[model samples]
Target: MLVSIELVPRSKEDLLRDITIVENILPQINVLNVPDLLRFDLRSYEAASFAYSEKKDFNVIPHIRAIDIAPDAPLPCVDRPEIKEVLVVAGDPPPTEQHEVYPNTSVDIIKRYQKEAPHLRVYAVFDPYRRSPKEELEELERKKEAGASGFFTQPIFDTNLLQLSMDWLRDETVFWGISPVLGEKSRRYWERVNNIVFPKEYDFSLEGNIHFAQRMLQLVKQQNDNAYLMPLRVDLGAYLTELQSFIVY
Candidate 1:
């Protein structure tokens, strides 16, 4: 199974620093996913270009927010030979309503990319928490029909939910997301803001998060699916070292 790491596009210096850290800590991890954050100055593809410049071997999958691009304009990353894939998302609204955005949905962009750039593999986002399993699966089917070659899901906290979603997407290429929630505040943010359903005995410490990630990775291995680590608000190197040790042993 291929493992990936999510890198936030903040600045050239920060992006390179994190890439180097991941390279030194876990050389096996070659896929770096860059998300498009409207609040940040650096666009996802720009940050991904920086990463590719630093390490040619890394498979950089930059996220393209459908709302940011017009229907007629070309994607900035599609022509680049180094970038073979992209993850398209509906994207959150801009921090302020002042920024102009297109009304395009992810499905619209996916279909357009498939027709316009057949060589580039497009991916769709799967949010299990936002809708019911039945509804989300139906929407995933819609994205699949739109010519999305694969999927990348939001972080799932429950094992049963993971299993169910994995079963639902059994034959597709999926990268299950895993992130660490360090404290009660972070936990509540997931619970209230993101609608994450955590188990009653969910661990809130660093070790607890590491153990859960290991378990998730093992399950993903058993199912022959890929997994991605989104180490939000944690020491990337240390957390990856621990997770890597689990894989090594």
Candidate 2:
């Protein structure tokens, strides 16, 4: 099973510091994913290129918002030889409405990439909480038809939800997302903003989060699927150390 870790691109210095931290848990992580935050000056592909050039074996996948690119324009990574993969998302609206955004959906961008940047593998977003399983499955099929190579899902706090999503997407390449909800505020953000459904016995401590990550990883491995870790606001090294230690391979 492949394991991927998500990183935010704040600045060159901050991104490298995180990469150095990730280096401590080498061999356990197979890929690094950089998200394109609108507020951040450094683009996801730029950060990914930096990491790709710095690391020898590790793969880098950058997120690109579909709305940012013009419908007729080619994908951003066409000239970036270092970035081989990208995740297409129906990105959040810009902080200011004065900023323009394209009307293109993720599917539109995926097809665009397929035609223009065939060398780059495109991954689409999957949000289990946004819609019902059947609806989300249909959306995923549409993405597949648009030439998405794989999927990266939203962070799942419930195992049952994870299993259902896994069962539904059994034949496809899926990176099940897992993240830590450290405090009450973070938990509320997930519940109120993302609409995540947590288990009744969900524990909100670091130890609890580590234990949940372990279980999720073990189950993902058992199903022969990949796992994506989004250790938001947490200690990446220490979290991975405890989580990866529990995995057999």
Candidate 3:
């Protein structure tokens, strides 16, 4: 199984913590994903990634949103030799009512990005937690046809969701997204920001959330070998000790 960690550092303090977290988890995992979302600073993401790279022999994959990328503009991370893979996402639009660079769906981004840098393996976003599985799978099919190298899923809170849709996952190279929701504070944040509603049966306690994701990881790796842990601005250090103990390979 390929286990990887993802870090999102919005400021210098977070960047320092990201470095410490990576350093603390040294030799535990090599692959780390740094996605560019929210404020959109490619240089900061690169700098943080470079810091992590200096500490560990890690294959740090930085994410670039398609809308932020201009038409026929230079590919920043893709052209760089250190970054072999890039996660291309049709990220959420800016918080304001009006924004520059109108949104392009991930499929649209993939086609244009592949043309721009065919050598860089592009992993498109995959979240099957939608209301319609058929529609989601069909959208994934469109991405598959567009020459996306792999898929990155949203956090899997309900394992039954994946269990019911084995066929949807078996075909692609997936970096399974798993994260610990600390408590109601985190839950409400996800709800307010990302529209992720906590189910009535959802466990909101800190230990419960971590164990939930850990069990989900075991179940997922039974079928797929790749698991990606994304601590979306959450403190990853808290989850590291327990997660490292649970993962066998």
Candidate 4:
């Protein structure tokens, strides 16, 4: 399986530091939700520079959030010519003092990218657990029609849920699954940072989460022969080693 890490770089220095860390761990790394609240700058020049630097040393894939695909937005080809593919997500809007920015839908961005950058393959993000099987399949079809070349799913803990969604969609497009590892404290931090509201009795821990990830990975490999594991927010080297032992890559 090809392993990759996602980084949210808040500044140029942060971007550089992320690149260095990524190079030491995975052979390829993707910058997720770029130009969004975390990165904030998605101009072609800036993206190209980051892409160039990342490509010079490591395999870096630049991401394009849905909000960045404005009708009048310029192409990134001018600056970073090496960026051949982009992960298009309905990015969160600018956060307010009290709340986080909700992402606009991704269909518009997929359409815009198809019209503007024909050579760049677009990837659309989907959360299977967030919707019913029918709804998930419907969204995937919509995105495919809008010119998305592939689909990436949110972090999933339940394999049965994933299988049901995949069975319903029956799509030929590439599907990337995310598995995030967060300790108890980190999970709480993420919830607060993203303003995620959960049940009052919910509990989040690294041990339980990693166990869930392993189970999901097992089922995914058992059901889909072509599925590749994509571990997020953790050490790639360690995850890869564990996956190598578990999955028949």
lDDT of every model, 2 decimals: 0.90, 0.88, 0.71, 0.56
Across residues 115-209, which tens digit of lDDT does each residue of candidate 2 receive? 88899999999999998878988999999999998999999988988898888889999999999999899989998888888888999999999
| Cα lDDT tens digits for candidate 1, 1-249 | 888999887899999899999989888788989999988999998888888988898999999999989767887687788888999999888899888799999899999988888899999999899989789889899999999989999998888889998988899999999999999899989888788989998998999999999999999988879998999999888999989864431
Ranking by lDDT: 1, 2, 3, 4
**Model 3 lDDT tens row, 12-114:** 4666567677568645677777767666444424753574556557777777767766665776565466777777777667666555664567787788767
* Ten-residue region with minimum lDDT total, candidate 3: 40-49
Model 2 off-target regions past 4 Å?
A: none
What's each prediction's clash count? 0, 0, 0, 1
Residue-wise lDDT of candidate 4 within 1-249, one digit each (tens)? 333345454576766665565555543434332333443544433544675665564434455656544455574442346666677766665455444333447887777668877888777777665557578678878989999877666654445556765675455554446455465666565455543334343334544555655666666566552333444566655655554444444
TM-score for candidate 2: 0.96
Candidate 3 stretches with Cα past 4 Å from truth are 11-13, 40-45, 96-99, 192-197, 232-234
Candidate order by TM-score, decreasing, is: 1, 2, 3, 4
TM-score of 3: 0.86
Residue 165 lDDT (model 2): 84
Candidate 3 clash figure, as a count: 0
Identify the runs in model 1 with alpha carbons over 4 angstroms from their true place: none
Q: What is the lDDT of residue 178 in candidate 3?
A: 85
